[model samples]
Every structure is written in C-alpha cells, then in structure tokens.
Target: MEATFEAFVRARGPALLRYAHLLCGDAGRAEDLVQDALVKVYRRWGPDIAAPSAYTRRAITNEYLSWRRRLTNREVPTQLPEPATRSHTDAIAERDAVWRVLAGLPRRQRVVIVLRYYEALPDREIADLLGLAEGSVRSLAARAFATLRAHPELRDAASVDRASRAEPSP
Candidate 1:
C-alpha cells in the first residue's frame, strides 16, 4: 500500500501541481495546496479506493476552496500595486493577461472554469467534485466566461496575438 501510494504520487504529482496552480493562480499556493491534499490522501491510502487521481484532484479542489473561504475576510490590503507593463506581442504576456483575468474571478467560478476547460471535465463530474448542482455549475461557468470575454486586458492581448499570427514573415 505504501509503495502504491508512492508510485501514485511520483506519477501524478506534477499534474496535481498544475491543477492546483490553475485553481489558485499562484505557484507557491498551488504547492501548498497539493501538499495538503497529498497528506490527507496518504492517511487513507489503501488498495480498496478506486481512481486515486480523481480522489486526489477532489482533495486539492476542496482544500483550495476551503482555504480561500478561510482567507476571504481576514486579509485586508491597504494599497493595491500598479499593474505590470507587458509587451502586447509576447505570447507569454498574452497568457499572463488571461491568467490575471482568471485570477480576478470569484473562487467557485474560477474553479468551475479550470475544471471545465483546463481539466476538460464534464459538467456532471465537476458538479460532483464541487458538491454543487449541475445547473449551478453551468451558471458559474457562464458568468465566468462572460467576465473573461469582457475583460479589456484580455481583449487587447488577444487582438495583439491575432495580429501577430496573421502577419506574414518578412
């Protein structure tokens, strides 16, 4: 059982980290989330459980959501930092812009988007993972999509990317 758990972690750790990063939008926080989830999973590690990957992912998502809820009202920043200047034509910049927009979304909405688009999970599965109704999952995704589509920075970055791609090489 211990060897099986070790093998599972070795194989799935990076993907779990990526999923956590998508959920939380910070690499450090993502690592913490994955670590916490793995600890929880390790306690229950046994051959009887089916689909350890799904179980671990659900654990990570639950940890992220609960952590966000705990921190939601406690942290109060006195001042906001100015946004960083980014080159419009840089693909990395475009991805950063999109990530910024995603980071701005409410936690549940962001989770829904990450699960639906990034993880490519069906609505039913997402709903089950989140303990939300399927209709609520759809509504959250709709709102998140609308917010992403309406973000100005994302719009500008996308246009720049499109123009860059469309230009013929000199």
Candidate 2:
C-alpha cells in the first residue's frame, strides 16, 4: 500500500501541485496543503475510492475551503505559487492583473472558476467534487464568469492569448 501510494503521488503530484498552488496562491503553502490532504486520503484508502483523481480533488477542494474559512482579510494575497519568471515588466503586470481578478473573488466563486475553467471540469463533476448542488455550481460559475467578462481585457481573446504567451517557462 505504501508503494502504491508513492507511485500514485509521483504520477499525479505535478498536476495536483499546480491546482493547489493556484487555489492558495502560495507555493510553500500549496505543498503543505497537498501533503496534508494526501495524508487524509492515505488514511482512508480502500476499495471505495474507485477514482483516485476524483478523490484527490475532493481532498484538495475541501482543504482549500477549510483554509479560507479562517481568513482574517482577503487583502493580503496568499503569495503566488509560481516563482518569478517573466522577462518583461508588462508581463509581470499582466500576470498580477489576472491574479488580482481571480484572487479578489469570493472563495466559492473562485473555486467555481478554477474548477470549471482552469480544470475544465463539467458542472456535474464540479458539483460532486465541491459538495455543492449542481444548480449552485451553475449559478456560482455564471456569476464569476460575468465578473471576469466584465473586465474588458479578459473578454479579449487576443489579450488573453498574448498573456498566455508571456508566461515564463517553468
């Protein structure tokens, strides 16, 4: 079981970390969070977990929700997960703008955006993973997308494409 767990971590760790990092916006905290969540998954590992990815995502979202519950204020950004890599000032500014729009959202809205857009999870799966009703997921996603779309730059595909290109290689 230990070997099985280790193999699974090796295979899925990168993607898991990516998700956690964006949600928390802090690399160190993201590592800490994923490690903590995985410990729980390991404790409960059994035949019922027919889908490892789904199980792990539930753990991730649950952990993030718990972390958000105790926040003092939303002003202090949980530092970004990615290290500095952009070459130009414009790139860094664009990245910061994107994070500001995302991080400023309420936790539930943020989760909806991250899961639906970033992970490309369908509404049904997102609902199950986040323990939310399907209609609630749809509502939250719609509101969040509306907020994002309200930003003229976000609505422009060319700008988004250019911003994506500016992201430095990790």
Candidate 3:
C-alpha cells in the first residue's frame, strides 16, 4: 500500500532526521535540512514521484549538497554553537557514541552508511541519489563499514552483541 504524504512523514520523519543528522553532524541543522527537503518534495508531489520515500531521500541529499556549498561561501556563522546534551541512559550513550564515530567519517562515506544501513536503500538507489556508479556506492559502503568496524564504540558493541547471542555454559 502507498503512504499518503502526511502518513509518510509521520512514519519516516524520525528516520529522516537521523539520516540528516548523520550527514550534517548537528541536530538543528539536520532538522532544517529535512524540513527544506520535505518542502521541496511536498511542492512536487505527483504521480511522477511514485516512491515518495526515494524522492524524499534524493531531495535530502541534494539539499545537503546545496546547503554545504552555500555555507562554504559564507563569511560569518549565523548561529551560536550549542553544547551537546548530557544523558544518563545507556541507550542514549550508545547512540551518542555511534554518532560521534559517524561524525568523523567523510561526507560521502557518511551518506553511504546512513542510506545503506539506516534507510536500508540498495546500492543502485544510493548510487542514483549521489550521482555515482553503483560500484562506487558499494565501494563507499565497504570503506565506510570498515571504518565503522574499526571504531572502539562499534567494536565494543559487536562484542556485546556476540556475547548476548552465545549459548550459556552449563
């Protein structure tokens, strides 16, 4: 079944924000990027965009690129830097750790990881969104995953996951 515009946004909004946050490395900027992309998509909604999710993903990527370009040309920063929020929850800590590692990745690699893992998009779609060959998308994802795997946060997470999956000894 197809999702209505409102339903689509309601269902996918948080995921989109996560993707955007990973791309931009800031929550407020990520919200703005997703909003800008949604406005563009909301304007162009029609039969031509059969897959609204894909359309929105592409819009988000394009908006991020355009915004980054424009930002590079700016002389002064418009907003004051915000401090990172502190939280005591383990889930929150784990998420923050993942975000910290992801923030260190190159833009292309970060986008690839977000789209491939977070959005569950295939290589062909990711390639098309980023205007790269499919092989390039796979290679980028491979490199990104390698980097992620080497990070202590991810390595520890993997170890915990493995331990949880192991059978208890008698």
Candidate 4:
C-alpha cells in the first residue's frame, strides 16, 4: 500500500496538476485543488479502483466545478492567458489560436477539450472520469475542434510567420 501510494503520487501528480491548471488557470489554485483531490483519493484507495489516475482526475474536476458552482457576489475573470506566449516555433500561432477558441467555449467544452488533448485520453476514459457519456465527450471534442478550425484568427498564416520571425536564434 505504501509503495502503491508513493508510485501513484510520483506518476500522476504532474498530470493532475496539468488538468487542474487548465481548469483553474491559476497555479496556486491548481496546486490547492490537486492537493484537495489527492486527499479525497487517499481516503478511497482501498480496493476495486482499476484506474487510480482516472479516479483522481474526476475528483479534481468535481472539486473545480463545485467551487465554480458557488454563487459569488464577486466577479471572476474567465479569460486564459494566451498560449502564444508559450512558444516561438511556427506552431505557436496555431497553438495560440487553439487557446483563443478554447477561451470562447463553454466551461464544460473547455474542460472536455483540455482533458482530451492534454491528457491524450480516449473518449470512454474521459466519460468515466467526467461522469459524462462517451458520446458527449466525442461530440464536445468534435465541436470544439470544428470551432477552432473555423475561427478566422487561426487561419492567418502570416501571423504565424510573424511570430516565428520574432524569435531570436537560440
């Protein structure tokens, strides 16, 4: 059990953080969320969990949604920082486009896309973790990708070239 817990932490901790960060868009909050999820996971780790990472990810996702569901008197910013600043390669423009489209999507769609692309999980696993139907996962990803493909901002190849040219040689 000790070895199992340690191995689980070492292997899945980073992945959990990635999912958390994508959902919360705040590093500190993401860490807290993942920690909270890990505690919940610890309490349930006795037996019959065939997929520990999936179980933990569901916990994290549920926590984020629960926190968001709280009716707050305060306003929250919904925008994510540009994924463009993340890269200097020609890929940066396309990647940034993705973020832009991702930002415009509904929260559920955004979460679905992040889990599918970032974790590289299949639809069935995503469904199991998210408590969503497999068909919902497939449609959500498809619609999100279609929206991205149709977004005009992403099609400006010149902008990609511009970003590429702006990079200094390593």
lDDT of 4 by residue, 1-170 (tens): 76898799998788788789887667777899999988988888867777887788889988887766673732343444444353575566556555665666766777777776677777777787778898897788667666666678777555434422332221
Native-vs-model 2 lDDT? 0.76
TM-score of each: 0.79, 0.79, 0.67, 0.71
Model-by-model lDDT, in order? 0.78, 0.76, 0.72, 0.71
Sliding window of 10 residues with minimal summed lDDT for model 1:
74-83
lDDT (Cα, 0-100) at 12 in candidate 4: 79
Winning candidate number (lDDT): 1
lDDT of 3 by residue, 30-78 (tens): 8999999999898887778988887898899888778876775432222
Ranking by TM-score: 2, 1, 4, 3
How many clashes in each candidate? 0, 1, 0, 0
State in Å the error of residue 134, model 3.
1.8
Global CA lDDT computed for model 1? 0.78
On the 0 to 100 scale, the lDDT of residue 68 in model 1 is 91
Tens digit per residue, CA lDDT, model 1, 1-170: 88999999999999899999887766788899999999999999887668899899999999998999887553322211235455644655666677777777898998887887678788888888889899998899778767776788776645534422332221
Q: Which is the winner by TM-score between candidate 1 and candidate 3?
A: 1
